[model samples]
Target: MVETMRRRGSSKGRALDLIRSQGPISRVELAEITGLTQATISNLVRELLADGVVSETGRGESSGGKPRMRLEINPASRFGVGVDLGADSSTFVVADLAGTIIGRLGIDGPGALGPADYVRRMADDLAHLLDGLDIDRAAVVGLGIAAPGPIDREAGVIVGAPSLAAWSEFPLTAELSRLTGFSCVLDNDATAAALGEFWLGATEVGSTYASVYMGTGIGAGIVFDGTVYRGSRSNVGELGHVSVDARGPECPCGNRGCVELYAGPHAVIARAREAAASGGIDLEFTGVAAADFAAVAEAAITGHPLALALIEDSAEYLAEAIVSLVNIIDLDHLVLAGSAFEKVGAIYVRTIQHIVGERALSRHLQHVSVRMSVNGTDAAALGAATMVLQEQLSPRSLQSVTLA
Candidate 1:
């Protein structure tokens, strides 16, 4: 009897995980997949439904019986805010429990604002955006800020982000909370993007995955065994700092031959500017201009020799880093994200896919799925919004908050 009860309890727990990850399933389908009795599935569904996490979304087509009511996550019951603080810009998105962006505000960053002033500016921006939204302020469960880093997630501080020099040791979470009067959570841009994908993008897939953010710099977010792993100091996936060249140029992170010094958007743009200047060509990549790497890439696609060489070199450097990563993590999938990748991303995807397919050990186990993020160019911002949804809606994250 006790063994039977234990199995029943285990089934319920698995059911909850599924509902949280892939919910709105009917009792019959749940039973078939979970191998639990329909009665047990019904019991747990009732509990979740009562807790206001799940709701009926009309009836599904019947399969030789009365149609079952379709269940779905109740996004309106809770909501969270996502803030993506990037070198070039900042974005704010308010998301419901279902990871839907009901209201959004994208802001140009105060590039020169220091930590204190930046937070204050962010506060004003957030307030202005919130005021415009038709949502009830009370249902906003928290705010999740996705900032470039080195970061200290536990302390809620952004530490030594090169792009936002003023954001160093910035108590962004506290300041934003003070400004908006809501609980706030903070994470590195890549990590938050990983969570965004894990929770909303690849939630239907396997447990382990990586979200690679290819922005001004390269960073990765790791989801392992169904949880976001932030590492020792929330600085786990600083992949850009990986030394791919022994005699390469110096990096701001005090490393020589770091990948960022070679392949990051800054590096690519610098190369473009250098080429333009040395060749006496008329091209401008100065001051807040989109990186010329994209233009160079386009030129390469059209048979421009110089542009093709530059992109190929960048892709090779990226391939080296990605190959190393696949060996270490053997990830089930790799999501290429960020604006840098958005423009010339195909080259990256194709190049990395070829290398990893030909080299990584996991190539035999399963062909590593290297694909562009569905969120595309605005992924960080969208993921920033998703950060809110995960915290409020995901079961594990929900445990961290105390609802008022």
Candidate 2:
């Protein structure tokens, strides 16, 4: 009996997902896409309309006699929350059923706080955000968290974050669920960004690509044929620690010349400071690395030779790393996103495109395209919210069921 109920839920969820993605579509079209019988589609659509999950948008053109009624998701039926916990800051966003961001909040450099304090603060912030929006608490389906890796996602523990050491082995998901009274899902920030792009960006379904997310560190998220390529243990795509120079400075990951050392924001700022000291250039800015990087980016954009050189050099190293990644993954499209790329993304995009065009293994057969994220710095947070939508509404197997 439980299995039968689960199957019914799965079928209903699949129908809802189809409508969300390909609506306003007719019952015949839904059947065609889902490979379900017309009767099953009718039954599902009826249940959805009765439950306020879907609605008849309008009539579609008829082939011969009767006009078909089209169906679409009712955007106000449910909501999802996404949180991006970065090294320097954390972002919270609330998205409605149609994947629209309705509310957003941020806390700068929250990693300095202990785990318990951070979680409490996050819960409080979430409450404030929902309350300010005047949204019904019962309407929220789930919350999705985008945090740094390596994370034990199945166990709902953050094994360790290079930026937030105090969060190691923390039961983040369970704690957030307990505090918010909503089921939560956790994923690496980069992977979440990829999912965000898939759901909200202009990419078509079933297209393969890579998204390189630059925050306090660098990581890549690989999407193949529309699904994130999470390796065994759900901790794949640690592109930063990939060794680029065998004889360079040793990284905390025990590798020499990891890409993060040369291409990350801190590395760029450190190099800029050194150049400023030697060349007698006054590098004035607040102590925050993100702000300082922004200063450098503005200088580079304004054609300051020293600033341009520093940014170009960092871009070169990043390009080299991306070339290797594209060659290995055989990806044709790449997205550069995160707080680090918020200002200087164009430089990185241009440099990476030039190198990949000349160096990628498949360059002879196809031109690789590199571009900035359409969702901008909020991609990870929005992706976190989409994660909840995907898990609760778009399960891959019809036999699998999860309590939301």
Candidate 3:
């Protein structure tokens, strides 16, 4: 049994994933896919239906005798709240079980605000977000937070996030839960993005994949057999910390030549700024990380020599780290996410795909699908909400995007 998934409960949870992803499917199909007896599938589906989690959408094509009834998730049965606490700004969203965003709000990052103060403001923003929607407050399952980590997953805390200093050693979830009256869960930004992608139901059922998130730093979120795989302590996918150059600069993570040191947005923006200062590039410099990175990303996409070179170089370092991840997990797909990738995504995608195709040991098995997030940079916030839905929307299976 997959232990990470076990913590969320199983049997029913597993069935729900199958139905959410492959529905409108029949109970026969569920039995076939899950190796459960028809009786078991029936019992499970009955619970889901009674709970208003699953609905019988319509009849399916007859295999031999009567057409079978198809089952699907009921989107409006539940709701979740997500907060993507980012470096430059944060995103707040309310999503139904279907993963369709109901309401969204964006605001400045915590900046120097202490964790307690930030939580209070966040509670107000959340109230504002939910107030705008005609949603039942009781229907919101809980809250999910995606942030940069050194996370204490069990404690529901973001421990010493290097990028968001005031958040370090904070009981983020407890505070949010206390103020908002909803149980809260916190996870790495990349992991949350991957879950958000999984929650969207855009991938093949039971596929193994990973999302590579480019933000102030780099991280990966892995999904094995349609389940989010949070490694021990929920820090499974630290792609940025993987070494691409053993001889390169020292990283705060106590690693030499970490891939993030070269490929992450901070490094990219820093390079662009130095080049622009030296008259090597013609981009306007903004001290703000998001603005600066966006400027570089825009120039790179437009084919400016210095901008392209810097981004491409970062992609090369990123490619090295990605190949390592692919070899380890043998993922079926790779998703590129985060605000950092919003503009210069093509450069990274093309470069990473080239390197992975050439180097990944699993190349003989199948081509790994690579693509941009449908939600773009907003994926983390959406995924944060998915984490909540993952808990509250549980019946026996998977729900990404919309259920009905």
**Candidate structures ordered by lDDT, highest first:** 2, 3, 1
User: Candidate 2, residues 1-404: lDDT per residue as tens digits?
Assistant: 99988887778888887788788999998888888899999998999899787999889988897999999989888888999987677899998888889999998766468888889889999999999999998888899999889898888878867787788998999999999999999888898888888776457566669889988788888887676787777788888888889999998877899998988888988888887878745678676777888888888888888888888888899888988998888896899889888878888999999999998989999988899988789988998898887787666521111212
Best by lDDT: 2
| Candidate 2 Cα outliers beyond 4 Å, as residue runs | 1-10, 397-404
TM-score sort, best first? 2, 3, 1
Cα deviation of 293, candidate 3, in Å: 0.2
Most accurate candidate by TM-score: 2
In model 1, residue pairs whose N, Cα or C atoms come closer than 3 Å (at least 3 residues apart or on different chains), thus clashing, are: 24-71, 115-166
lDDT of 3 by residue, 1-404 (tens): 58855643566777777677668889888989878789978887898899888899899987799999999988888898888997688899888888999889999977778778878999998887888897788888999999987798789887766788767777888888999999898888988898888778766766988999988888998887666777667777889899888899999888899988888888988888789789999887656788888998888778798888998999998999999999988888999999988888888889999999999998988898788887788888898897888776553443222112
Which parts of model 3 have CA positions greater than 4 angstroms off? Answer: 1-9, 37-40, 61-66, 362-365, 395-404
- Tell me model 3's lDDT, rounded to 2 decimals: 0.84
- Candidate 2 backbone collisions, by pair: 88-109
| Model with the higher lDDT, candidate 1 or 2 | 2
Q: Write the per-residue lDDT of candidate 1 for residues 203-269, one digit (tens) a residue.
A: 4454567888977778998777656777777787888888998788778889889988877777777
The CA root-mean-square deviation of candidate 2, after full C-alpha superposition on the true structure, stands at 3.1
Q: Give the Cα lDDT of each candidate.
A: 0.74, 0.84, 0.84
